[model samples]
Target chain A: MYTRQNQKNLTSAQRKRFVAAVLELKRNGTYDEFVRTHDRYFVPDDEDGLRVGHMSPSFFPWHRRYLLDFERALRDLDPTVSVPYWDWTTDRSPASSLWGEDFMGGTGRGPDRKVDTGPFAHDRGNWEITVGVTEARYLTRNLGRPHKPITLPTAEELKWAIDEPAYDVSPWDSRASGSFRNKLEGWARNGAERWSNHNKVHQWIGGHMTGGTAPNDPVFWLHHAFVDLIWDRWQARHPGSGYLPAAPLDRWDRQRGRVLTRDDPMPPWNVTPAQLMSHKGIYRYEV
Target chain B: MRPYPTRCNPRTAAAVLTRRAVLRTVFTAGVVSATAAALAPVFRSRRTVAPAATPGPRPAPLFEETYRGRHISAAPAADGSRGGLDVRIDGRPLHVMRRADGSYLSGVNHFESFDSPLDLARAAVDELGSVRLAAAPAHHG
Candidate 1:
């Protein structure tokens, strides 16, 4: 099984190869397609099959499959090129090597919030934003702008999130304040702090990471790899929790009728939660 | 039913109008009252209750448009995946999404988040306010 390692752990050569592979993918137009898919999923309206991955308990599984799909695409080009995870907790500053000129790039400058440093920089001419809300085609960042700042989540907070026993509580969606899913997604508060986990990281990064087409940024892969890692950890902690909206299944979806179960078909993929939970033949995380 | 008195008292006749006239007046009064009551709700409905701002159509997906130096745009999460609302303004991105508990979420700020579309729109407007700043040359980065 292909092992996804931490971004900080990758050697210089590994980082170079990884960056090269990513740039190659961008050149081949594969990266833009991923951005297109993520942008489509982030569409705001809830009408007719809109937001199933996020806010719902399925967020974990859906992203598991999404990251896997992305990893598979990278492997298709070069088997040695594995997706890495970004530990924001360690590389807390915007000046981290991940954002250095050779890697993803640093914060946007001036009013445009356009990122000028790094390989994925807009002026680099190699990374063009073809999919997103605006027609402007350029990679952007506002790393900790004066109004908005990035706060890397702490390990204690992540530990608190994982410690929660239930997979999700009532209203098992993104808004469920106390549920692990809601807290991990960064919608609900963590008692002391208003922002937490995945959502916090996204907002903290701001710029392209916060946008609908976040996948346009190569950092999206590393960030999500960490999220997936957290999921695996949560699963290990609560092996019996299983998935939610399964069984006794009386929940009604006003729009679609019954709520989705673990056995229900996941969109954008043929597999179901039952199929994703194990991750046996698919791949493994090298945590 | 009450039996009619044999003698018609003139005083009573003077006090009460002709049966036909009385009936006409009563029916007319009843009709007017009913009509007023029936039309009451219509008038009330027409009266502006607070004049709360009506939410406009969900803003169209802004594709790579820049205002001032900030950018405003939207897009679906990913096709074939469970979808969610993803909005980006300059550096901040807002997610208007549903939760597992059936509640919706709108990313307002680092410290605050909301579930209402109106709130989401208002937050977005405020966030995009930076776009109103004086326009600079096209971002070269």
Candidate 2:
């Protein structure tokens, strides 16, 4: 089993190897497929269709598998390279080492929002937005969206989601309040803040990170690694609460075929949520 | 149901260019031209005119507006993702997806889902502010 470490803790060599492997994937076109898959799965519940990647109870497990598959892909290129998590709660600024010139690079500059700095910068010719299933042909970001500056999710905010006992509830989707899945997925739209936790981090990264085709930016892996880590933490906090909708939804329900129940097989992989409920042997997150 | 083309001139070419890009990625040039011809009526009002006589009451089009100086147009997504609307801000594409709860989301203001594509587009314009959107789109999916 491998352990996912925090980005801030990675040795310069480990970071270099990981970055190299990612660039390799981008060069050979495997990376674009990852972007495409994420875009394909970015279905919303209102579409009332096959929604697995987000806005549903499967948010945690689905991403767990997606991240795992991505890690495996990277390992194929370099066994020593493991995806590192970016703990937005701590290493939160655009200037952090996570965005250092030697690593993921800094935010977009100028009016076009082109990320001129970074290995993935368009001028670098290594990471063009090819299969993002998106419009931006080059990597772009507006860190903190300066005009409307938003911060990375705070530790306190994450605590609110991890503390929720129920893994998910009936009518399992973004609006399903009290469900740990939606809370951590950051779909709560009431009160002062409309976006929280996971969603807030994406918002703070703006540009390519702002939509379903977020993988266009390499930080997507680090950000999602942290999200996956949060899920692991949530699981440890509420061990008794398991994946929800233990059985399938009623046939009459509109979401019956769309939302994956505990045992339902997620498409593109056919793996059940129950099967991915644990990462004890597959991988572990280092705080 | 697929989204029809949104009304506007220059924006139509941008949307068409995006559609053409997606078609070239996934379909043949013949299909691309056919699609362009099909959508031609939306912008090419001089040709392919609609009938004066119609059926039952027509529903108000869901997306067609200029929010905060950014012109957004909605049409059926060429990729055929469910409830996926092919929207463009100014002359650049603004991809919008429908969530299970009937809200809208896009990469520009990606964190939260808005009530409709228009709301989502407006929020994206607000988030984008003065930054101009890069032209053209890709269909790597």
Candidate 3:
């Protein structure tokens, strides 16, 4: 569905139309106002009464609906416009022309911006080495299997690792929550040194689990696209992520908590991943 | 019958017909006069109208230096190094890096994911503290 090779290639006319569409939605009060109202999508169980693991199985569906709504807003503004996907895999190296000035703003040189050269060059003393460590440990123990500790790679290696398919790892496990909680506690009791180890682990698994919610980092989208691509690749490789049996208790439509039976209507809008993979049309990025 | 009708006929019919014609004329004149007065401003305004084609403000530069690649954009930071605060979203740590040119970049985990760099930065600032500018690394090839 992505037509353009690069966002820079988007015409001024297209950008104007897209902006107009988004503005129109905002003017009409049709835009998602959640950013103003809520702090985050999933509140940590420890901080808020909100249960961490209690997010509905329909989380994916809800996000899909939200994104489609935004896409519809864009389409309403200009029917010719399509949402562009970032292909991080092809532009694996930081030295490629892909990192040019017209693209990401910086001193106009180097992968990570030099501190003295441009705007926003400093470390925002705000980096909570502690929180970073704690989170890193939680993910490692839960999503990753026990292995010999690995060293954090250079920034270039980190970038390379994001797209490497050989690093594919499973994020969910049967005992993920407990393990995550235990790791959190261990990291908390320990000092910054303990946290540093967590940071290393964070970098390692982070490069592997390329698709999670980390949008602030420029690499987040590319990583996630690869992650999504991996899922697609997996289906192509293994046929499916496994299917839910057609049972009375299996609710395919999680929002409504309604069970999906064989006889039930499977509308195109509410297509299951299995159904999505089965369609003859599949998306692949043009390198 | 002819003698009785003769008394009521000619004089009264002539007077009534005259009054009706006068009233109709006056009413037509009043309506026409009012319409002309009402439309007078429109004609005056049209004559004083300014040129139809004035230039609009120039469009914003076609491309923002901040964004790189097809979907990539740089986040700005004060420190020489583009690195800013990092945060965890849905169990992932996002490194908020600023470019030397003053744009920003943060990692996104999915193709269809809706998180933006600004979103991630704001979250980091919210969780950690405001960003402090750091020294740019000495070795930038």
Candidate 4:
């Protein structure tokens, strides 16, 4: 079992080892495959397949399990490593040294490549990219009916089309693209409303099924993680937002028309939220 | 259920401690026949009570003006759980769950719209009295 001590207090050497393990997972296809196959990991519940557009109560527990799975994969590769969380609160400036190119792919500065230290520096507010009619049309054609698209795109397809390359008209390029800032705005202003709509359909499907139209996308987990992270940050700032007390935990039970749960055993890797709460036993992002 | 102890005299405390130790030993021996008999039925009866389901009518969104002067006044439950006030705002119902950990969770519009769970929980403690639990339906089972 991972302990809080091991994760909460990571050594410099451990950080290097942890980053290397992440890169290794990225290379060996393990990370990509897990994101693709795991129902709770990267599956979105919307027409456009936007993962963060809305989230369910199961969101936190699901990512908690996914990150733990990644951590375990890392440990299996190297026993001595531990995960670290990035406390974005402590370092609000986008130019904070933590984002250095040596860690994430971008140059450790703002999107403009200049050293920035304001709230907008790492500010995700302006990073949002709207799913306008043009992109939405392309996505609808390629993805087919939102309820049951022709086929779920591979993570490679999703990554290349949306995250990696510029938008093109190819039928293969079905998702939207834009800066992270624009997406954040879309989420803030319309996130709850959009999520409520998407969740209604998702809950109708009972929350679990692979190979459907939108849920099939592999970008789901990363997208939701960012959503979950946003909610986390929002809660930190507002401190009064949350699910209703009567917001039935029953809705969270995968057996009760929802696809995931706080305790559901994710396939090919059987783990649960009870196990992930501890910092020591699992791998986590450096928050 | 039963109020066990608020305070104990040294003599009674010592005797209680000794009794607890003795009970632990006796428990291993399976010899506390009468005590076990007294506890079993209570446990069984508790299992028979229906679990509480999520409440309803869904709370409507509370305007910032609604919470301007509210302050929590009641002490928390012994177990650290908090009690909340349910209030009707423009004919809509809201339920807030507050706990002593300085955290709360509230449901707006019965339970349809949820704010951040942790924030709602904290708000419950901060905004008591301003709200009141809606009357339980008269025909509840």
Ranking by lDDT: 2, 1, 4, 3
lDDT of 4 by residue, B98-123 (tens): 21121232332111122433344333
lDDT of 2 by residue, A120-218 (tens): 888888987865433557787889988678888888888888889999986787888988888888987435888798888888888778766788889
Please write out the lDDT profile of model 1 over residues A76-170, one tens digit for every residue: 87888788899877888887888876667787775556678888877778888776544446765666545645478888889888988777765
What is the alpha-carbon lDDT of model 2 when measured against the actual structure? Answer: 0.75
Query: Per-residue lDDT tens digits of candidate 3, residues B6-94?
Result: 12235534644575565457556766655545544443332223222224542222122222211212322222122322233322344
lDDT of 4: 0.32
lDDT of 3 at B38: 54
lDDT on C-alpha atoms for all candidate structures: 0.61, 0.75, 0.30, 0.32
lDDT of candidate 2 over B26-69, digit per residue (tens): 44545545555554434333222322322455424356787767
Off by over 4 Å in 3: A1-40, A43-63, A90-227, A243-287, B1-141
- Better candidate by DockQ, 2 or 4: 2
Residues forming the 10-long window of minimal summed lDDT in candidate 2 chain A: A128-137
Q: Can you tell me the CAPRI class of model 3?
A: incorrect
**Cα deviation of A222 in candidate 2 (Å)?**
0.7
